[model samples]
Target: MAASVGRGAPAAGPEAGGALWAEVWALLPGTEEGLTLALSGEVDDCVRPLLRRARGLLYGAEGRPGEEAAAAALRRLGDVLRDYSWEKLNAGPWREISKAWRQVYTYGCLFGALAEVAAGRPLAPAVRLCDMGLLMGASVLDNVLARLVRVLQQHLPREQRRGAAGLAAESVRTEPRPAPAVRPEDALPRLRCPSLEHFRDNYLIPQKPVVLEGIMDHWPCMRKWSVDYFCQVAGCRTVPVELGTRYTDEEWSQKLMTVGDFISQYIVNENSMGYLAQHQLFDQIPELKEDISIPDYCCLGEGEEEHITINAWFGPEGTISPLHQDPQQNFLAQVFGRKYIRLYSPQDSENLYPHESQILHNTSQVDVEDPDLVKFPNFRKAAFQSCILMPGQVLFIPVKYWHYVRSLDVSFSVSFWWS
Candidate 1:
C-alpha cells in the first residue's frame, strides 16, 4: 500500500521540497504507512481520536466536506494544543517533549492536507494548515510543510505554478552585504610609549590619530584572553550581539545570546559576523574587569578622571564601525588582534557629508572607501589619517573625530571615552 501510494504521487522536483518530505516522513512516526496506523487504533489513545477526526475532515468524510472542514479541524487542533499546558503533563520537562509534540501536530495536520491534495482536493486547504501551523509556533513543522506545498505545486499547470513560485520567492529572504573595506590615503603616526605631556601635546591637542604602541603590555588580558578562556569564564553570561557586519546597514539588528554561543558561531566558525561592540561587559562580568587598567592618556581630557566611560568592542574579522564620530575623547586600546582604522579630522566635516538626520548627524553618508563622486563631489577633499592598530597599542581619537573601524582578524578592543 505504501509503495503504491508513493508511486502514484507526483514527483516533488529536484530541490529542497522533495528532500524535505522525505525527512518529514522519517521524523514523523507512523507517517510512512500513509497515516493508517495513526488513523486506526494502533497509536496512543490521547492523539488517536484527534488524528482520526483530522483524517475524516481531510478525506471529506466529516462535517461539511472540503476546505471548510479542513480549516475547522486545523483551528480546533491548534486551540487544543495551545490550551493543553504541556508543562503540567506527567511527561518529562516540557522543553524535552515540546519538539516531539510540535512535530506530531504539524505532521498530523499537514499530512491530512497532503492526503486531500493527493485525492484531487484544492491546494488552499494544505496552505491554510501550514499557515496556521506557523501561527501556532510550529516553526519546524511549518518549514517542512511549506516545502511540501511547493513540491505539490509542481503538479499544477504552468500558469498556476508561476503564481505559486512567485509567492514562494517572495517568502525567501536574502543575506546582508559584507562590511565596506578600508582604503587609506595617508598613514597615521606611530608612537612608542610617548610621555603623557607628549601624547597630550602632539596627538590629543592636535586631534590626530596615532598608534601608541607598548601601552597594553601590562594588561593581563593580552595574554590570558582566548576563545577557550572566555568560554570557561563568561560563557553563560548573556550579552547583546550586533548581528550584521556593519551597524550602518538596514538589515543590522541586535540579539541576546550567551558568550559561548557567540564565540562558537561567529568566532570559531565564519557563519555570520557577531559583535559585542560598545558594551559595558566589564561591569556585568567583574572578573573580566580585573584584567585591564584604564590608560593614562584619558586624563588629558577636560572631564573628571573618575567619570570616564569604558566600553568593550569584541568581534571577528570583517566587523566594521562605519565612519562616525563620538562626542567624547576616545582612547581605543587594541588588546587581542589587529584592526584597520581611518579617521577624518573634525575640520573636514563639510567634506565628509555628515547625514542630515539629527540622530545620524555624527555619521557620514559617503562610503569612504567607494565614495560616489557624482553625488558628493566635495568628498574628494576630505583629509583623513589611517593606521593598523596592533596588540598592546592605543589610538587616541579626539572628540568628534570621524572614524571608521574594521577588524582585520578576530579582535578585542577596549575604548575609554571621556569629555
Candidate 2:
C-alpha cells in the first residue's frame, strides 16, 4: 500500500508546515478537534525542531512534494528520540529515574508510528510499531499513533492475532527440567483451592508461607504460554535483561533486546545467562497480562487494597536469585517450569548475615545453596522450609522472609507484592 503522499521533493512553505500537522491529525479518528505533544525540559528542545521539520516535509499544495522527506524524517525522528532517551535511561541508579525521560520516548514512538503509517504497512507490522512504543514510552503525547494503529487493527482477522503456528510445533531447544540439588528437610503445605478465610487465618495472619494449588488451573497461561507464543506476539518488543550469571556477580549488567532475540540467543542457544528479572512486564505488555489474573489474596484488606507491584522473571535453567527479602508479602506464581525455593523465617535474619549497606540491607551476604561455614558460621543455625514450585503453583512468601530461588528449566514467573 503506497502512501497517498509523495515520495520525492515538493514545494514547501509555512502553509506546508502547518498542513503536515494536519495530515497526521487527519489520518487518525476523533482528532478533528486537535492534538497536542507532551514534551518537557532539554530533551524537548532537541526533539521539537525535528518533529516540526518532519511535519514540514509532509505539506505541499501539489503532489505533496515534501512527502518522501516527511516519511524519512519521521523514521529518523524516532531513532533520534530513542538515542536521547537511552542516554538517560541506561545510566545507573534505575530506581531514582523519573517519567520525564519517558515523555521523549513517546514522541519518538508517535513519529515512528507516523512513519510506518505513511509507508502504508500491513496491520501486524503497524501494530508492532505501536506495541514497541507502548512497551518503552510513558503516557505522553495525544496517542495519535496508538489511535491509528487501533483503527488498522479492527480489520485484522482473529486467527492472525492468535498466530498461525502453535507453540508445541516450534520447540527451539528442549532439555530436562532439573531435579533439586539439595532436597529440603521439610516441604511447604499445599491446599487445593483453599478458601479466603482459611488462607488468611492460616497463612496471612500467622505470616506462614504456603504453596497454593488448584486456584490457577483456569488461568489461560497454563495452556497458552510457550516460547513460540512469546515470539509470535512480542518478538519485536524490547525488554531489559540482566547479563552475566546473576546480579551479585561483578560482571553482571543489564542490556535491552527484543524478546525474540533474547529467546533465541540466551534461552534457546544457551550462550550465557540472561535473566529478565524484576520488571513490570505486565504493564509493558498488557495483552500478555490478560493471560493471567491477580490473586484474590492480594485484594484482602480493610476498606480498599493498595495496588499490587507485579514483576516478571523469565530466564533459562540455572539462573539464581541470591538470598533476599522484601518488606511486603509476595505471591510468587510459577506460570511454567519449576523453581527450587528456600525460605527462612524472619526470626532467622540474624543467621542470614544481611548486607550492612543500606542499598542491600534486605539482602543476605551468605549464599543459601553453598554457605561458607567458616566466615558465615551462623548460617548453619537458620532453619528453612523449601519446595520445588511447579507450573500453576503459587507460593506465598510472608513479609521479610529471607528466601532464595533457582530455576530448574526455562522459566517464566509473575510475582504480585502488596503491603
- Clashing pairs for model 2 are 10-65
In the range 105-129, model 1's lDDT, one tens digit per residue, is 5545465545444334455455445
- Clashes by residue pair, model 1: none
Q: Which regions of candidate 1 deviate over 4 angstroms?
A: 1-185
**lDDT per residue as tens, model 2, 1-419:** 22223322322233222444345446543321223454554554666666555444333222232455556666776778767876776676766555777666666676676665565444466556566666666665454545554454444454444343334326655556557754545788888788899999989999999999988889999999987787665565566789866678889998877676677777776667898885557766666788988888877743244367888998888899999998888999999888999999999999999999998899999988888999999999999899999999999999999889998888999998888
10 residues in a row with least lDDT, candidate 2:
2-11
The TM-scores of all predictions, comma-separated, are 0.56, 0.79
What's the residue-level lDDT of 144 in candidate 2? 54
Decoy 1 TM-score against native = 0.56
For every candidate structure, what is the RMSD over all alpha carbons to the true structure, in angstroms? Answer: 17.6, 6.1
